[model samples]
Target chain A: MSESLIPAETLERVGEVLSGPVTTVIDRREAQRYAYAVGDENPIYFDEVAAQAAGYRTLVAPPTYVTHAVVQPRTAADLRTDGLYREGTRIRLLVDRVMFGGEEWDFLEPVCVGDEITATVRLAAVDQKEGRKGPFVRQVRETTFVNQFGDEVARSRMIGIAR
Target chain B: MSTDTDTAAAAPDLATLEAGQELPPMHKFPDEAQLFLYSAASHNPHRIHYDREYARFEGHDDIIVHGPLQGAWLTQFVTDWAGPAARLLGVTWQNRASGLPGEELVFSGTVTSVDAETGVVELEIAEHTSDGRLLMPATARVRLPTT
Candidate 1:
């Protein structure tokens, strides 16, 4: 049997910490940019008047907008190089090729503009899989987002396939 | 406020949607520039998304689209049909195949179930190529307005 791509030591630390508890303020401009990037024409995400009509205090983010906060930096100059798959010691020790497998997100509440969102991320699980080409590792990172008031905004499970 | 009127006008009529109803299909042909914008907006610095040479070295014909980009399109699929009043409760999706840049991907969904009392509906959503190859298969739960 061929050896797995990820080391056993790395696999042993499945539940180890990967990134943050990183906090980011969800700006309306960023939200709109994300919406535009996805080609979403929803006025609630772009126009304040439309958002007000939708019963949001201000512009509401698109459903996947929270994802941007998951990867974005806290500040323009805060170069804290810590994130899932971002120069982390454990990630660096893993396999060579990495691909985004998929993800599942549950929205508990709408994340509106000006909401200070904090994300607590952890390496949830790791497993070795037999791919057609060779052996690969599947890593799942779970991130929980909350508002400044401590409201649970959303929970996500992102899976990455590395070989 | 006019927002209220617009909200009311934009709300999806829950009574009009039924189980097995197919939502309108959204066609997307994301080019390199659009993919770059998506990567930029999400702050993803993955080289495979931009550097064609690196992507080729990694064994892909062209730049690969971000999985989250597909997820975003699926979210739009539901929201566009449900309107602003509808709340997207959750979505679970898997990327079965790689989506190449400039490929015509069709996003579509089917109403699996609807609960009148809770005003929540379940949908089976998917993204496919123009020739009908499924790239991503997903399920979503959305809360619709009862009133």
Candidate 2:
């Protein structure tokens, strides 16, 4: 086994809330913008009548747009050299480069425009794994989204790999 | 239930839908404008997404498409066929390779399992460049309404 790159403190942070209990009301324009951006142009996201005809209560957001809707605004000054916002709680790792590994999502309930949604991100896991390339650290940030009715609307696990 | 942009796809007919059936392929031609719009919409200000020189300096062929943007396409690929009435139970994707702009990305899938009573369908799906390079290998589960 490779020498442990994950510090004890980092490992200890597992299960801790890394970001928001931030809440935002799903907006029609914003959701539509996202759909249009993705070139989705799905009727359920555009036409209310079509959405209703398709069994939706109203125009609905795309499956993964809710995650973007909850992003807390940051000023350009907060941007790092990479043009990405400086996150509040940075997970320390011995490695320097980090790459997006993958994403897993569970959509339990439909998220519609005008619905209040709150998102909370937790450090689900951080561990060292031996990969074909070398020893790498796999970190999972789990975000759970809840609707105004207190229903768990969706869950997302974003995995990051750093070596 | 496989539908692309030109054709309006509906939910799968449980009686006729079976395992080993292939979903109609969906094609996406991602270009600079689409990537830019996605960056703006997602609030991703990463220079690599917008700056070509910076991307090259960082060791990439060109300014690349956002992983999440392709992810949205993957979901759209499934949802368009599932129809609005069908609820997406879950979906997962692995970022295997970077997708550059102006590339034709194709999304295809095979029905792996179907639960008739509960109306849940499992799919093994993937996003590949038209050149046959795999970008993202994925899986999705959707619950189709009986009605």
Candidate 3:
């Protein structure tokens, strides 16, 4: 956790909220576009007919596609105001600093088109380290993906480093 | 839209390429359309990805691409080069720099070592900008199918 933007209390709070599920509906265009964006060109992701022929009734998303579902605000102030960070924060604790570090995910099932999925995130761990770059904070977040009716789909372990 | 037939390299393909042989080129350009597509595919609603104004306020010049999108592309680059007979047991990478809009990226690597008995080859691969900045660096182990 970064001491600047995220306080221990804030981290705790964020952890609490991450326990429950947050739902978002999948849109067709977005799904297809995402597949194209990744340069996957995998028909199972872009064409419903192709996906059906491949044994899926609906178009499926690439295994790592869930990263696009959560939208972050434009401003640091907004992040704080929305309770994304601690009050009067300057540095972001999520994604390591204020940006992306890295991520890893495992797909248990495909996220088919028209599936209303919910993701339940958990703060797995946070550790501080001193490296050649500088002081760094590593945070691990675990998220479980599920469909509308609550069937588990997959799990992701994302690690972010803060400078 | 690459078919398996397109990837039908001969068995022991790695045997043909020298230890330091360069992998085939894979291109990536940070564009608005690509950003939006990545966001939609990844279900990532992160505004910094497709919203320049939002990204500016967040300290980025333009929308940033999702890190995973880069990773996925990196995976594809390796899998595509490994050919149809190669089974990708695992592909992973660490993001060193963020990829923003309009930056040209190319994925390239060299064969580091090969284990013939196991049919596995180790590679040191990275995604680099046109200016030669490293974005994501990773090691990949590919196991080729034997008949």
Candidate 3 regions exceeding 4 Å error are A1-33, A42-63, A66-97, A105-122, A143-155, B1-19
Candidates arranged by TM-score, highest first:
2, 1, 3
After superposing candidate 1 on the true structure, give the runs of residues whose Cα lies further than 4 Å from its correct spot: A1-12, A70-86, A91-97, A128-136, B1-12
Window of ten residues with lowest summed lDDT in model 1 chain A: A77-86
Q: Which residue pairs in candidate 1 have backbone atoms (N, alpha carbon, C) closer than 3 angstroms, thus clashing? A: A53-B3
Considering lDDT, which of the candidate structures 2 and 3 is the better prediction for this target?
A: 2
lDDT string for model 1 (B1-147, tens) is 000111223445688778998777778888888888998888876677888887888788888888888898888778877888788999999989888976888887899999998899999999998789899999999999888
Candidate 2's docking class is medium
TM-score of chain A of each: 0.77, 0.98, 0.68
Top candidate by lDDT: 2
Residue lDDT tens for model 2, A7-95: 99898999999998999999999999999899888889999999999888899999999999998888899998878998899999999
Instruction: Report how far off residue A159 is in candidate 1 (Å).
Output: 1.0
Among these predictions, the greatest TM-score belongs to 2
The DockQ of each candidate is 0.44, 0.64, 0.32
Task: State the lDDT at A129 in candidate 3.
Answer: 68
The estimated TM-scores of all candidates read: 0.85, 0.96, 0.65
Superposed by TM-score, candidate 1 places the C-alpha of residue B11 at a distance from the truth, in angstroms, of 5.3
